[model samples]
Target: MIIMPQLSPIDVLKRSNAAWLIRDQWRNILEDAYELVFAGINPYTQDKKAPRSMNRQFDSTATASTVRLANRILNEMTPPFDNWADIKAGALLEMTMDKEQIAALDQQLSGVSKLVNILVNSPTAVSARSAAILDTLISGMGVILGIENPEDDVVPITDQAVSQSEVAIEVNARGEIGGIYRKRKIKVREIKDIWPDAVIPSDLLAKLNEKKDPEIEVLEVTYEGGPGSNVAWYYEVLMCAKGQDPHRMVERTYDVSPWTVFRWMVIPGMPYGPGPVLLGLADIRTANKVVEMILQQAAIAMAGMYLVRDDGVLNPDNIRIAAGGMIPVQYTGGNGGASMVPLGTNREFDLGQLILDQLRTAIKKHLYDGTLPPETGSPRSATEWIQRIKDLNQDLGVGIGMMMADVVQYVRRRVEVLIKRGMVPKISVDQLTTKVEINSPLARAQKLSKVQDVINWLQMANAAAPNAVATVANLEKIVAWISSMMGVPPELLYSEEEKKKIQQNIAAITAAQAQQANAPAPSQAS
Candidate 1:
C-alpha cells in the first residue's frame, strides 16, 4: 500500500487562509446575486379594487427567493479546488505572481484546480481555514476602519498585559539593581527603622492580659524634622479591656509622619470610645493653622470633660479673674530718720499668700462663670486669665527682697563660723573687713561706736603673743599653720624669695619690742 504523508501545520495554515478568502468572495457574490434575483415590480396597482395587504407570507417568499439565489451564486463563485498540493502551490504563487501575467497564470491553472478540489472535499478543514482567514481579514479591516475587531479586540488586552508585565519587570529589575536608587534610599532613611525599638513589642498582647480597663490609648505625641520633613512618635498608655485583643495594659507605638500627628492625638473620642481626652502635640510653627485647629479641638474636649451638663457649654461659675498690685514700703525708725524696709517678714509673707489665694479664687470664679472671651465674656478668655496671672506674679516679686534678706543672714552666720575656726587667717582680716564694708549696707549705716566695737572684737580674737620668735623657721611655721587652717597650700602664701623677706620683717619687729622693754627699766632706776 502507498503511504500518504501527513500535512504540516504551515500547510494547514495556508489552506485556512485560502478557504477564508474563498468564503468571503462567496458571501459578496451571494449578496449581489440575491439582490438581483429579488428585484421585482409591485404586483398590485394603486387603483386595485381590494386594498393590497403587506402580509408575512409575502415577506417569507421574498426571503426564500433571495436565499435560493444566494446559494446558486455562492456555488458558482467558489467551485471546488482539486487537492491540498494544488491549493498550496496556487496560494504561494498568488502571493508572488503578477495576476496581470497570462503566461504565469496558465502555468498555475492545473495546480489551482487541484487546490480547489481539496478545499471542497474536506468540509471541516475548509471551515477551520475559513475561520482563520476571516479573523485575519477582519483584524486588518479593523485597523483600516479604526475600529477594532469585536472577537479580537486585543488593544486593551495588550495594554493590560503590558502593565502587568511592566510590574513584574520592575520588580525583577529592582532585585537586580543591587543598591537602592537614591530616591528610594532617601525615602527609606526618612522612614526611620524604629522596628527594633517599637513601643509595642510582638509579645505585648500576652502581657496585656493582666489589667483592668486594658484598652490601649495614646496620650502624648511629639514630632521632629524640618518644616516639610517632620516625623512623629506617639506615647500611649494601654488599659486592659474586659474582653479584647490584649489583656495587660502597657505602651505602644503610633509612628506617623509629622503632617497630621497632632490631629491624630487630639482627635476626640479617638483610641477609646468618643469622649474628652488630653493630648499634647508638638509646637509646630509652620503648621499654624493646623496648630490652631488642634488647640480648638483640645479646648472643646477639655470643656466637654469638665462640662456640668450635656449641652456642650462650659459653666460660667468656673471662670475666675485674680488681680493684684504692689506697693514699696519705707519705715521711719526712732534712731534713723527714714529707711527702706520692704514691710519685713510678717507683712510680706501675709501679703504674698493672700495674693496667691485671691488669684486662685479668680481662676475658680472664671471657670465657674464660663466666661471665656470671644465665645463668652471678656474675663473668661484665656488671654485675660493669663494676663491676670502675670500681673499677680509681678506683684509677688515685691516681697522677694525680704525673703532674700533671710538668705543673707544664713550666709553671714556660716561665714562667721569659718572665721572663728581659723579657716580664714588674720592677715585676711583686712580683706574680710573690706568685703563687709562693700556688701553690708546695714553694717555701713551703723554707729561709729558700733563699728569700733566690731574692730575691738576682731583685735582680741586675732592678737598674737608678745616677744614671739621671729626667725625664718618660726615665721615659716606660723605661715604654714595659718595656711593649713585656711585650707590654702603653704606654697601659695609666699614664694621661696618672698618667704625670706617676710621672715626678716618679723625678726626686726620682735628685736625692736625686746630692746624697748629692756631699755625702759634702766631709765626708771634714776
Candidate 2:
C-alpha cells in the first residue's frame, strides 16, 4: 500500500527517528561516525566487526530484510555514507512497519544518535581532526589562551585598542612603566644675603682693638764712599735694650768695622813625591810638615779672631767671614798677567814662591831641630797656633815692613780692644806672635820678593781660610805694590824672651861640648 520511492540511505536516515535524536546537523554527521568506525577496522581482513549490536526485537523476517537492506545501502553509498543501522532503523520507524520493529528501531536509533553526539562533541574527537580547524574556533572566542607561534600573523593582547576612560600609562624606552616624581623645585629670593653675620662679644672685640708695641728697634748704618775705593765691606752688631736710644742706633755701626789684620797660614810647597807641590818642594814628607805647620797657625788665628777675650767694644773679634775657603785657581798668563791668584793684596808669583820656600825652611828647622813636635804630634789648638805664628812673624822681621809697622800696630791695638771688651779671649801673646808670623801677608812678601809667586801664595792661603774677604784681582794689586816697594825676603828674628831661652840652651850645649873636648887625654901611662 505505501510504496516509498527508492530513498538513498543517508536521505532515509535524515527523515528517520535517528536524525531527530541528533541535536545538530553536523555537515558530515553520520558519514564522520561511519568513517571513524570503518577506519578503526583492519584493512588486511574483509571480515570487519560491527561497532554496534545487530540483533534486536524486530521480525525475524524483517530483521533479515533489514540486514539485507543495510548491505544494499552499504553497496549503494560512497565512502561518505550514513551509519547502516541508523539508516535501517530510521526507515523502519518512519514506515510504521510492525509495532515491535518500530519500537526496536527507535531504541537502536537513540543509541546510534547518542554515540554520534559523544564523538562529535568530545575534545578528544576534535583534537583527532586537523588542529587548524580547532585553533580557528578558539581564536574566534576573542581570548588568547596561549602564545602564538612566531611565524603566525596573530596580534598580541597588548596591541588591542583601549578607551579614553581607561588609565593613561607610559612605558619607558626599557619597556617598563614610568613612576611618579618624588622631588620638588623651590625658588630663592636672594644669593648675596645667604650667610648670617657673625656676632662678636664686646670684651673680645676690645682685646682685638688693643695695641702692644715691641721694645726692639732696628738700626741703619751708612758708610760714606771713599774717593778711589768703590768697594767697602759691611757688617752688623747687636746691643742690649737697656739705656739704648733709638736715635743712637745709627751710631752702633761705628762699633762694627772691617778687621784690619787679615791673616792666613801658608802650607808651603807640595808634599814629597809626584803630587801637586803646594808648598813648592818635590819632597812630599817635607811639604806635609810645612802644610801642617801652616794649618796649625791658621787655626789658631781663626780661634783668636773669634773666641779670644776682648774689651766691651765689638772690635775685630766680632768680625767673621761666611766660611773658610778651599777653592783653587790655575795661572795662565794673559792681559792680567796670571789667571789664578789670591783675592787681595799685591803680591806676584815669584815672591809667592819665595815666601812659600822660606815658610818651608822655617817649618823644617822646627821639625829637624826638635824645637817643635813632629807632624804626627798633638797639634796646637787653632787659636794657639795662629797666635804663636803671629808672634813669630813680628819677632822674625817677617811681618809688617818698617814703614807698615804703624799699620800693624794699629791692627794689634784693635785686637787688644776686642780682648779688653771680652769679645775675644785672653790668648798668649807668644801664640799670637806665631799666628802673625805665618799668616801676615806682608811678612810673607818680605821673606820672599817673587811678586807673582807671593801673589799666588797669598791667593791660595786666602782661599784656604774660612770666609776669606780678599779677591784674586785685588791680590794682584797688592803684589804689584810690594814689588814696587823693592821688598826682599826678611831674615829670621827673635823676641827678648825667645832670645834669652835660645842663649841659655846654647850655653848649656856649649858647656857640655867644652867639657867633652877638655876631658883628660885617654891615659896612656907606659
Q: Model 2's lDDT to the true fold? A: 0.29
Give the per-residue lDDT digits (tens) of candidate 2, residues 188-283.
111112112213245533443453422232211222222243332122211123353211211111221222111112113310111011122223
Query: lDDT (0-100) at residue 459 of candidate 2?
Result: 65
- Model 1 off-target regions past 4 Å? 1-492, 505-526
For model 1, give the RMSD to the true fold. Answer: 51.7
Output the lDDT of residue 413, model 1.
Answer: 27
lDDT of each: 0.27, 0.29
- How many pairs of residues collide in model 2? 97
- TM per prediction: 0.13, 0.15
